[model samples]
Target: MRPPCHAVLPVIACALGALFHATQAAAALKPAQLAIVINDADPDSVAMGEYYRKRRGIPATNVVHVSIPGKPRSIGVAQFRLLKQAIDSKLGPSIQAVLMVWTAPYAVQCNAITAAYTLGYDARQCAHTCAAGQPSAYFNSASKRPYTDHGLRPSMLLPTALPPIAGPPASLAPEQARQGAQALVERGVAAGARSLPASAYYLATSEVARNSRAGFFPPAGHLPAHRLTIRRMTADVLEGAHDVLVYQTGMAQVAKLETLAFVPGALADHLTSHGGDLLGSSQMSSLRWLAAGATASYGTVSEPCNHWQKFPNSAVLLRRYLGGDSAIEAYWKSVAWPAQGLFIGEPLAAPYAVASN
Candidate 1:
């Protein structure tokens, strides 16, 4: 997902909701020591920072909301340096994560700073521009590579959630989709033979496109789940990999969430005033597809789904991916009337299997 700082940055204000809405025995991250860097003086961003901290139990002081004044979308190298200087002055090395929440001031510029944070690069060493197709491509002049997806960093010890790509496929026609899929297959084959963890890719189908009311299952015409289609395709292309996985997240359920999505006040301001589609609810089907069966997530940005009424489907898929015992049970639990009594896991874990003699 894009970092909080970008031409159209989408930060994880509600990601904290996903991260720590409930308590479990598993280890959880402390929200304190996390700094939220905002450039625009948008009260919504500030309110979000406060909403999450207080409502979610994030330590108040941990949320630092900074405003950059009169800064253009493209901050020249000089202005970039000054912005960095200001951030570094107040930045305590103890800060765990940085959320750049500016959408109007410039998302690409925001990416410049946040990229530095993710890469473990010295904030001062951040450059001014990133090349096309490069991670920091849309970032302002003082940008830096924030690892593969520009915002996601690979954890040395744990498996990271791979991001899923959203938006229109490179090819819209069946033939183009076939060709594109074939190319990706070839690339995976090469990467797998080299013994590297393969890049995972998934797609979401629109409701009208598939003519389905539900959102979790792919229609008959589309590619199936990881085991049947994706993994099979990967095997066909590449040799010698036991752990790599290729999969397709379902689309039927996602459409439900899309129908329910409403742009929040803060992001609405960005889109209306600044002329960009920065704020709105994520497609439920899209989020499920992203979270399916991955230890972590990466890819195009999707809005947080915790607050939505139609989010139980998302929770079910998340539970399934995160270790919900069974998708059916997870769905039932999430949809049960008491709503507040549901005991979904905090860090949804993979389901534990029963041993047979």
Candidate 2:
């Protein structure tokens, strides 16, 4: 009972094996084009920001530091406006993409922080949860210089992937989460430029509402030209896969994620009302994909009401990824209405790029 296609990033691998090795080719999103935002209040944010900045070779001028006394889950529009102003004031002209380090504050009102920063805060989206939000000019576009072409800089969050608030206890939770974010950065660097022999799994679950985008899954087959394979399955879950590049499904909480291994620069997420509610108690958060080894993942901060346009179109996502777009670019272009969706992961992982690095 799925309708048609459509629809939107922290992340780059799972096990790091022969299935996906280091790449050497080209990347579209260069280090100089990226800007890193660090929250001085949160220690993890500061540490991961420093590490990712160094690893990616981001220019010193492309860094912005802000202080939020309390790292709340969602900030008020007034506060976000100031935050956005602070960030915008510091970014240089060459900056095209932004990486906000930290898991909390992923949303502003109902709009995801990433969308709010890149597209400007839209109060209309917060006015209605299920209504259509603003359309992105960059959706499915071929523009490489988003900032220069459209005055928008696509943003992604470097999240810890740890279950928010109530989850299993850990002795060194902050340190461990910081390490997790760093590992994600490493995977992104390793994914730079490589021809990956991978598979994209599209699991069609019985959750009819959640499966609205299932029809848009890439035709299940092999593409020898790209050295990629797409699998459209009728099951609710996949098991024992060694090379998972792109995984899209619809469920409140997915099962058996730990059993699979994801290739570097992987994209994985579920479609649901609150998957983007990273700190909310109910339903699984999109951060689980990162913990499960996915490099980038997406989830809606507010209820999207199963609108296909609000989620990432698997067809466009795979096409952009195979066409050599970075994880952030491909993910951002796939979502037409993304004000409510949070894009999380490593933003610059481009495993398929053929350009000179």
Candidate 3:
């Protein structure tokens, strides 16, 4: 026989209380520690820069502008060094994170733009290409400022939809790009009040090689009360889910994407080849998630990084976010090997930073 409803109330209350207490101890990253980098040569970059500065209230001194040709998806090592030097000279040493407001030149040869800025461009980091690079100092750290804490600064790209013909599109016609960028700020602000309806996580168990990441999924019953609800699925794909906060899976292409409804501050990513190569059309690009309404996403820039450790750990990503880290910080910390990974999205969204009522 089952216990009466009244008898179960105490146990439920205890679980909720424990969750509330854990959330209360979390910490958040400050906006002042972030710097905005704009590619002045690109019109779309300039427009997005202005919009982000106004939306995030970033100080004028913290905004650094550099001139680089808009064509060619990659830049030479020397060119990247000069660009990095200009940024360092302009922003000083106080800033710990950067938001690059352009999509072109996402790579500096073999290195992703985000990795180049954060760890500095070095052939050694990409010597093996598929092999892991040096581990990040910012990974799983509790420091408020990365510069002071780890001597390493992390960065994220505020991606723009590429023009159909390789030239800049009508400046005003880029409203779709602005929608995703604006959503990040709006969602971060909204997170401070009400939590999303529910949070869903998907784990695919069909393919043995791709299923390596499934072990990290947290038990559903252990999740926080009324804040996030987790569901673990063994199917190869998940569909028709609503109000998704965090979605992780692995596949060459994820079908039925329209069936999932993402909350404004949601974070979603798939472990797949070329998902990080936003310029490629062969596989589903990570940018599609942003277009589909997710605030942030990640993917590998090159071929065949089958190492599960090279990707983001589902549990670490969720726990860090729930502990009040911003999307960038939590995402950076979740990945053990980020040298080849491209992190693109709104860096400052923090849904779990809100206080419980």
Candidate 4:
């Protein structure tokens, strides 16, 4: 038997409101809770670490340096285990998340670096890289400190994708790379002041399979009239949308990206396979959103189980962020199967975080 639509609305609203208030009371994770990992062998990684540390005011002791080489793109499980042990030993138990500053070695076998760190190096997590492995402990909880509440931590990658700059090094010039990385942190700080308006665009595509999660999008009229604007589109993509704070849709690849504008601290992502496979050629990379100026984004490194339930729910993400959760926290909470998804961008970008404080 199914409940009537009207009867379900209040229950849903109540649940969301309770989640919002509970999370509102919790503080966003601080820079002190993060342990920054830098690959000493890569100058670009080192520069990024330095820049992020200075910009976020991270403590010197919290920076952990490792000698992982910058090639091969993936490391052996045993090698990654050792690195994890080293990080755990150096940072102790106080750390709640890790910020890996290098672009290379993003995967440990089939597990993304962020996934491996947060959930540990389990071959099961790798066995089905496309499928959902496990639910994250930090999802939708009132706990600000992941280690304290869930006994599991969360992680994110900085400089997920580098800008195109011709250089002897060829990947990204050190200064240019640092600027790109620092932009994320700066935007997060700026979001604290509400310098930009709160808005969201939910593109409900005509593709039936892709739009399976469209039912989860919030009603446009229900959003706070003054602080936020919600737009629901029945097209493939929205055009000329400016200062977009949150944009979500499902498609193989997003089109007309150049015409869309993203404000600093904006959260944008499209549900698609292989978007999280940062270096793969199969589909559009999740890094495109970062390149387009969004502060944070999410995508699956592999197939992601192909069920709408396994993917992020737009309503949960928007409500959590509107209620003061950090970008990483809100995004993490919205997904039922996060083990396969790689959350990339500024972990601490919290536009609504200011209101709570």
Overlapping backbone residue pairs in candidate 3 total 0
Cα lDDT of candidate 3 equals: 0.71
Worst 10 residues of 3 by lDDT: 1-10
Question: Which stretch of 10 consecutive residues in model 4 shows the poorest summed lDDT?
Answer: 1-10
Tens digits of lDDT, candidate 1, 104-154: 233223232323333323222223211111222222111111222243221
Clashes of each: 29, 13, 0, 2
> Which has the higher TM-score value, candidate number 1 or candidate number 4?
4
Evaluated at residue 128, the lDDT of candidate 1 is 21
Quote the RMSD, in angstroms, for model 1.
19.2
Per-residue lDDT tens digits of candidate 3, residues 1-357? 111222212222123233333444355565677898888888878887888788777888889999988545678889989988998888767788888888767777777778788877758756777665666666556666787778777889987552222222333356655665566556655555555576767677565566666666655653655467877777767678887888888876776666788786688888886888776777777877776667788887776466655677676677677778888888888776677778888888877674333
From the highest lDDT down, the ranking of the candidates is 2, 3, 4, 1
lDDT of 4 at 244: 89
Worst 10 residues of 2 by lDDT: 9-18
Q: Rank the candidates by TM-score, best first.
A: 2, 4, 3, 1
* TM-scores for every predicted model: 0.34, 0.90, 0.85, 0.86
Runs off by more than 4 Å, candidate 1: 1-26, 70-72, 106-113, 120-201, 204-357
lDDT of each: 0.27, 0.81, 0.71, 0.71
Model 2: runs farther than 4 Å from truth? 1-27, 160-172, 193-196
Model 4 misplaced regions, further than 4 Å: 1-26, 129-132, 164-178, 355-357
Score candidate 2 by TM-score against the native: 0.90
lDDT tens digits, residue span 1-357, model 4: 121222212223224334323334245778778889888888877877887788778899999998887544678989989988887888768888888887667677766677778877757867665544565555555567778878877888876345531222246665665676667667766766665555689887766567766777776743442267777788887777886898899888788777877776789988787777766667777777776678888777666645554566777788777767788787777765566667788887777774333
